[model samples]
Target: MQAKAYLQHPILGQRLRECTQIILNVDGRSAEEIFGYPDNLKFRSCLTLFMTATTDNKVFKDALLKYFDGKPDTVTFDILAHH
Candidate 1:
């Protein structure tokens, strides 16, 4: 409901998208501990949700693409490497 309401205002939605940031913190925990075991839905759901969001959400995709003023790859690499 809130997401739908936000979508109603394109400018506001875009601004929100621009302000979003994601930290893929793999270093903080083991991969299995983070996503859960494959026998359960937690692992699949988390992966699927992320895949769908990144692939289907145009605004989110663009924001990620332009992360840190179009330095997503470099910045993300640095972060993951450091952390």
Candidate 2:
């Protein structure tokens, strides 16, 4: 079959278009409504399908030590005072 014939076939492109429209109409609006923020952020967040974190062995050890040390002190008097 021709490429255009396959694309135009009833079971393919038409159904895909319908599903895409439904998603764009419903989920797109809901996503915008839920996460839309008017205030300007200092930086724009860029998304990547593949991301990597790099650290030296010593740096990772130091960060791990700091994280464990800082955990217990995260809840301070100021936070308790709010309650």
Candidate 3:
């Protein structure tokens, strides 16, 4: 499913797009491949799992911090921090 279907805000949608790209290109991780049957995912669970590593809680934050070059703005980081 397209991100716009789940993400209502344009800026958030853009950020999600970028995050997905970073995970895929920079991190060499496929979001859809990791997330089986992507269309069937529960929005909240999908988002939470995407933002938090199943292996370790700190991994997600570390990944996000690195993705943003270590100085991510509060609003964007806040959303990632929650999960």
Best by lDDT: 3
Superposed on all Cα atoms, model 1 deviates from the true structure by an RMSD in Å of 13.0
lDDT of 3: 0.44
lDDT of each: 0.40, 0.30, 0.44
* Poorly placed runs, candidate 1 (over 4 Å): 21-83
TM-score, per-candidate, Cα-based: 0.26, 0.26, 0.28
Cα misplacement distance, residue 44 of candidate 3 (Å): 11
Clash count list over all predictions: 0, 0, 0
lDDT by residue for model 2 (1-83), tens: 23245345779645534543443344323322533553111001100000011221233223223323312222332343465
Q: Against the true structure, whose TM-score is highest?
A: 3
- Tens-digit lDDT track of model 1 for 1-83: 34445645779655644433232323354334544565223333323333233334554444333322322344334444565
What residue runs in model 2 are displaced by over 4 Å at the alpha carbon? 1-3, 27-83
The candidates, ranked best first by lDDT, are 3, 1, 2
Q: Where does candidate 2 have its weakest 10-residue lDDT segment?
A: 42-51
Predicted candidate 3 versus true structure: per-residue lDDT over 1-83, tens digit per residue: 23334454668645665655555354543333555464313322434444433332343445444433433345533655665
Worst 10 residues of 3 by lDDT: 38-47
- Residue 69 accuracy (lDDT) in model 3: 40
